[model samples]
Target: MAAEAKQSSYDGSHVENFEFYLQCSGEHESILHFLMKHLPEEFERIGADKSGLAVLGVGSGGGEVDVQMLSLMQSTLSALPITADIVEGSTELVAKFKGLVTKTDHLQKIPFTWHTMLSEEYMQKTKGRGDVKTFDFIHMIQMLYYVDDLTETIKFYHSLLNKNGRLMIIIESANSGWDTLWRTFSKELCNEILPVYRSSSDVLASLKSLGLKYEEHFIPNTFDITECFDPNSKTGQHLISFMTGRENFYQSFTPRVRADILNVLRSKCSTEKEGKVSFNSEMRCVFVYA
Candidate 1:
């Protein structure tokens, strides 16, 4: 029922709109709040003393969120030397992130190593190196959707954590608007190049099955997706492609399917009030302790 051999829209062409989508979604603010609230206390409990923190950023896109996270952690652990290992695959994004870091003064306080590879590749590299490093905190923010084996990926990252270290993750909650879009269009529009979409609920179930105890927090988010209703709009088409993980998803769909998808977007996936269409963009943050 799904499309065969379609490339994901997360490439360079779609990155701009995807960043816009993230801007409107308010996911970043929620994540910042979670970090500010939990990290200080968590660091304290983990015995913040002589040795500084070692952090890992998995799927760190454009490094914006990575910078924010490190900034806050720096504030909490004032004058504490920190080492960061950044794992990202996109050359352009990593360049942009590094550029941003160069301009920021506080970010320079935390020295970092850049790994231009996927998380699995980084894991294999580390294995080859023989456990030379252990992370005090590892974050996989809105990135697990790229990995094929979620449970194994989780375990691998968890194994990288030092004792009392934390692995934080963020993902869309099930039955939210994002989930609705994927579930509705998956039969015809699903992209094989992308990993199967898994929501926070699915992740929690997987963790439970593995006998892992974790803390969960819900982040209430919403975005105005009115542009998606107009098939002629470039941003709209880009968003459709992003949601379905297909390139030119609007163009790929039959005229009837396109219309139906729009109708469902307006009626089911979004709420219309004051002539503004807002999508249910709730997300969840899960914390697993080592």
Candidate 2:
């Protein structure tokens, strides 16, 4: 008989950090201002009279952040009556998001579709549809780390939007105190135990060098994850995928050395300085018009 693969090995409880991270990184306003780039005073503009607008959310993982954002966006666009669609790579997440929307009375009124698709596939379809400049607000939140081609990605969003439509790409700033501290605090741990994702700013610069005209914002959000590391939480299971490249990622140390590093890092990370445990993050919000 074939060896059974381990089930329930991945924990994603840290996803709860999405809300806290959004606050620490200041992503809350980025989405709203993203809409305003084209429609001056976007918060005040989304009314019934305006042509129903469409917003596309790319890489809307687990739809947790989207849930928080949607609440804020919903009330903001209560005036525009915009239709929003989310592009997610995970089917389970899509179902979860739909459930969240259905359960929430306020969200039920928002006309939204969840496209269970990857960014590349969605972009291909968007291009094949020949709908150049079709979106009013396109957003890529905390998803750029997976892409190798950031410029092409941004251009694709730009192509899919109408002249006045805007695309918002949110990335964490490498220079923020929160990020700086995390890197410093977790350097030994990260270098040995986890695979690091590329920074979003690198991609932003790549787009700018290509001569793309875009506006940007700095928003901060914080997260408290002491319990996420608890042995009892499913959140720890979420590390399986993130650990895919562990062997190479931990290449800097011997196996035993790496293990030691992980233990130390976890202890330090879980340490609380005061009544609450917290870390800050900076999100860079970029807006480019169609």
What RMSD value applies to candidate 2? 7.7
lDDT of 2: 0.55
User: After superposing candidate 2, which stretches have Cα over 4 Å from the reference?
Assistant: 1-49, 131-133, 176-196, 222-280
User: What TM-score, over all chains together, does every model reach?
Assistant: 0.90, 0.64
- In the range 1-290, model 1's lDDT, one tens digit per residue, is 01112112344765665675566566677767767777777766654553688999988878877887788777777766889999887776778889999999988777879988877788788878854688899998887766778888998898888887889888888888878877777676554555466788778987888888799988777777888777688777666666655668766778898788778878988899988899887788898988
Model 1 compared with the native: what TM-score? 0.90
Worst 10 residues of 2 by lDDT: 1-10
Native-referenced Cα lDDT, model 1: 0.76
